[model samples]
Target: MNRCYLTARGMTVGYDGVPLIRDIALEIERGEIVALIGPNGSGKSTILKSLARQLRLLGGQVFVDGEELQRLSGGNLARKMAVMLTDRTKPELMTCRDVAAVGRYPYTGRLGLLTDADEAKVDAALAAVQALELRDRDFNAISDGQRQRVLLARAICQEPEIIVLDEPTSYLDIRHKIQLLSILRDMARQGITVILSLHEIDLARKLADRIICVKGDTIARCGAPEEIFDEAAIRELYDLDEGAFDPMFGSVELPRPMGAPRTFVLSACGTGAPVYRALQRSGEPFAAGILYENDVDCRLARRLAAEVVTERPFMPVSDAAFERALALMRGCERIIDAGVEIGETNARMAELIELARQLPGYNTLLN
Candidate 1:
């Protein structure tokens, strides 16, 4: 059974004694990665800062492993938790190695010098983040992405039970983002609980075991990724009246073309996704048809196309479905065959193709 590693009871957080968010409640299990996602200025950073003790709580309390957070000494808390905020460290004349070694401060002697074991831990942390090669370089001289990785290395070196990061992937490129997330996933498997704020909702869906949706002064909702990541929920969460979000792909599509469909596309399997996007980009209202309900193309077409004529899954195109598709095709200014294969179940598609060829405005991407 999983244990509650961190808990917030009626917690209120903000800055300067003003509550930005109030009556917040959370229970985070050990070894879980919980991501905070919300629109900008929704108090995600404030909540993280308060939990990590960087900002004082305006009301309520936080507990870690049954110990009240405020009662713990600074060093004791640091030993139990590690934090890497977005605030860039601008220490002059400090090497990357020197910055990473700061994680050992809570464990170091009065002189604050690193022992042999401490040095090894720092080296391992840098290597874990793929920054060992930059250890001797000047900290301020590296790029923002590199600095982010180094800071993560510092957090890893701390060896705390819980790690809190704010926008950890802000400065990372695609490759580095993957690398860093993979490292955090590995760390969590070894029983380190992870908490962080992410602007990338798609990434949050993929990575977090649980998600906390922060909005308008407090947590709007909190649940598993499956419960929180869906078309309606995500659309409402971000107030997306302009565009569409697809949970299957974790992608956002531009608002669908307006007015009536100007083009009719016949596609099946996975072929129509690109064509649908292309038509959307060209601002051409389009329709897709003769697709089974379960076809991958049907999924995207429903989002981008003005109309979609769909048949039942695993069933051949019925006369009713074919008539609807044909009606759409006849109304379109142009008919496009998007490389639908003539197969046992979908053989009626060939008839549609022949009719399209007879029509005046006919195009086939098969060639």
Candidate 2:
């Protein structure tokens, strides 16, 4: 059974004495990756700062491994928690290796010098984050992505039970983001708990074991990704009235073309995505049909087109579905066959192709 490693009970957090987030309660188990997500200015940073002991709590308390936060000495707390803030402030006149060695402060002697073991830990951390080559680079001279990796190496060298990071991926590119998150996942599997705030809901859904929604003045919701990543929940959470979000693939779509559909597209097996995107970019009102609900094409179709004709997943196109599609096809000014494969499951699609060929405006897109 998993044990609660860190928790907050009715915690109120903010700058100085003014509370920005209040009545927040959360429990995290050892080795679990918890992601805090919300809209801009929703106090995600404030909550993380408070939990990391950078900002004082306005009310209530936080606990780590059953010990009250206020009761733990600074050194004791340092052993239990390590924090990396999102601020882009860079250290000057120091090498990347020197910065990563700072995590050993809690274990260092009065002179704050790294012992042989401490140096080994720092070297291992740099290696873990794939920043071994940057060990000799100037901290302020490195790119944001490199700096982030170095900071993560620092946090890892601390060997703390819980690591709190505020927007760790803010400056990272896609490759570094994937690499860094992979390292975090590996660390968690080894029994290190991670708490982080993220602006990317897609990454959070993929990486987090549990998610916390911070909005207004409180924690809006908290649960596993499956419970919190539904379309309605995400759409409402981010107040997305202009665009659409597909919870199935954790993708956001541009608002569909307005007005009546003028074109009909027949596509499947991920082929519709490009056509849907092309139509969307050209601001052409469109409809897509004869798709199984679970197909990748169907996912983009519902978001980009004015109408999407879909059937149950794994089932062949039904008469009712075909009729709806035929009616849509009749209304369209042009029909573009996006070259869906003739297959056993969707052999009924042949009828639609024949109907398209007889229509006045029929086009087939190749490749």
On TM-score, the candidate that comes out on top is 1
- Residue clash pairs of candidate 1: none
Model 2 per-residue lDDT tens digits across residues 133-217: 9999999999999999999999999999999999999978999999988989998999999999998899999999999998888
lDDT computed for candidate 2: 0.90
Question: Scored by CA lDDT, what does every candidate get?
Answer: 0.91, 0.90
Off by over 4 Å in 1: 1-3
Cα lDDT tens digits, model 1, 1-367, are 5659999999999989888999999899889999999999999999999999999989998999889999999999989899999897898998999999999989998999899999999999999999999999999999988999999998988899999999999988988888989988999999999999999898999999999999998799999999998778788878985348888778887899988999999888988889998999999999998888889898888888899999998788799998888888889989988888788888898998888888888898886
Clash pairs (backbone) in predicted model 2: none
**How many residue pairs clash in all the candidates, one count each?**
0, 0
- Candidate 2 residue spans exceeding 4 A from truth: 1-3, 313-316
Q: TM per model?
A: 0.96, 0.95
Candidate 1 lDDT trough over 10 residues, lowest sum = 241-250
